[model samples]
Target: MENSKMLSPEQLYEKKIHVIGRITILMGIGLSLLVPILLWIYYGVFPPMDNLLKGVFTVSSFMIPLSIAEILSFYPILGSGGIYMAYTTGNIANLKLPSAAIGMEVADVKPSTKEGEIISTIAMSGSVIMCELILVVGVFLLGPISVKLNSPMLKPAFQHILPALFGSIGAYYILKDWKLSVIPMIIGILFSAFNVPTSVAVPICVLCSIYAAKFLYKRGRISL
Candidate 1:
């Protein structure tokens, strides 16, 4: 208690974030399992242990590695509070990541800095709330929306949404530091040519970007 009182405001804030983050993570896990547990109890049915183990193994084979890679790649940008909220709410790559990036950009905050962390957390919270509200509204509108989305003329445009979204964001960063972007861009092109799965490509691209930045910084081609 005395030590905490002696700590700086930033230190106290970090301590609180960690404690609350852990509690929320545990609660999220419980909530995720609640529905399945309730259904199991009501039906008095359970899958065989072997079948469950096989299912777990199948998913874990790919998901564990992908999850580790995502954590490594995203942690620097998202920070503690932001990461907790983003992971809790889901849709990290498509929604939370873009929202955080745009938020920090608009606020002119560098990632990993105190300002960046606060902005990221706020952005993620907003994204989650907006997403939930959109989903609630979408439930009623889905039938009509799907019909329009599946129309032949609109189908082609819909197919480009992810590319358009990422491209706009990527263009800004690439322009900001073209030299640092070179090696990673080349690697990304190669991966795309090879039809690499995003789960596998993400970690590879992250590693390339790190090394490329280091090389450029050392050679006096780029600066922090």
Candidate 2:
């Protein structure tokens, strides 16, 4: 009781956040695994156990590395609350992170500060709720939306939407640090020249970019 009374509000808040975040993440993962296992049990047709391990490894090889990189890149800016919410909500790079950044921009709070942390969490939570509501509406309007989306005139855009989206967003960062960006750009070009699979190329380039940045920063070439 004495120790508890002596703890600061910030300390108490962090403790609760840590406990809640762990539980939420654990439960979410458990439920995700449970769904597939339940389906297998219901069907009475579980594949060879070795196949399951192989499948998990094949997916995780890329996903785990990418997730690690993203977590490292964004966690400092997001802080604990935003990190918790964003991880649970999904779409960190395209949706949640952008929403949080725009909110901080409007609020005039800098990232990695206490005020920024609180506002980012609120903004991301709201974004998650808005996405869920939009999803519900989309489900009801699926037929008409599908018809319009499937139109031949729009097919090319739909097919290339990912590149279009990332290209637009990536253009900013590339221009912001064109010198540092050159290495990754060259790496990407080389990968393309060699006809590397996107899965292999993406993660390799991501890791290479990370190491390159670290090397530059350590050599006093750039500021954090």
Candidate 3:
């Protein structure tokens, strides 16, 4: 029973991390689905199986592909530990993703490295804590916040939140690595102008930019 003799501390932790992460994710999913079923049973009003299937299909149709695409895109940035924490807490795209990226950048840690992975996890964990605290505080403040939020002067700001956030964050990344930015920028702009979907444009630009940078690096056009 004492496998500790065969493994180093780091290896032991890594194994534990993988097992715990998978278990936590599965448990969270199970609980989420179970709640609705329990409510249906308690109410004795289960919907038709066909209707349930339709609902599942409707949600899955968008979510499944988007989830897969996001995992591929975000994996390099978030790494394994960050992925576990982010996925567990949810909000990977808007909250966890930006928090991790910005944290790594501020710490001068490049993504895909061990340092980057730890920093990403730390950043995302902090974000999750802050978000939970904010949610708690928000419940009491929502009444007043809603008034200001609904004010005419604030509508534009609210409407532009995502754009402002992404624009600023994206600009920072592009500026930080301007050479890497060129190809992706061009691809993103051209496809967007041509009415490509955001989802399609994002992944396409990512792949094109990565290959483009690699090609440039190999050709000695860009260093590092």
Best-to-worst ranking by lDDT: 1, 3, 2
lDDT value, candidate 3, whole model: 0.83
Of the candidates shown, which would achieve the greatest lDDT relative to the real structure?
1
Backbone clash pairs for candidate 3 read: none
List clashing residue pairs in candidate 1.
none
- Candidate 3: C-alpha RMSD to true structure equals 2.7
Model 1 agreement with the true structure over 117-223: per-residue lDDT tens digits:
99999998899999999999999999877877788999889889999988887887788778878888898899999999776887888888888888888999887
Model 1 TM-score is 0.83
Q: Write the per-residue lDDT of candidate 2 for residues 113-191, one digit (tens) a residue.
A: 8889888888998999999999999899997789888889998888887888878767756765776787789999999
Tell me which of candidates 1 and 2 scores higher on lDDT: 1
Candidate 3: which stretches are off by over 4 Å? 44-52, 221-223
lDDT of 2: 0.83
User: Global lDDT of each model?
Assistant: 0.88, 0.83, 0.83
Clashes of each: 0, 0, 0
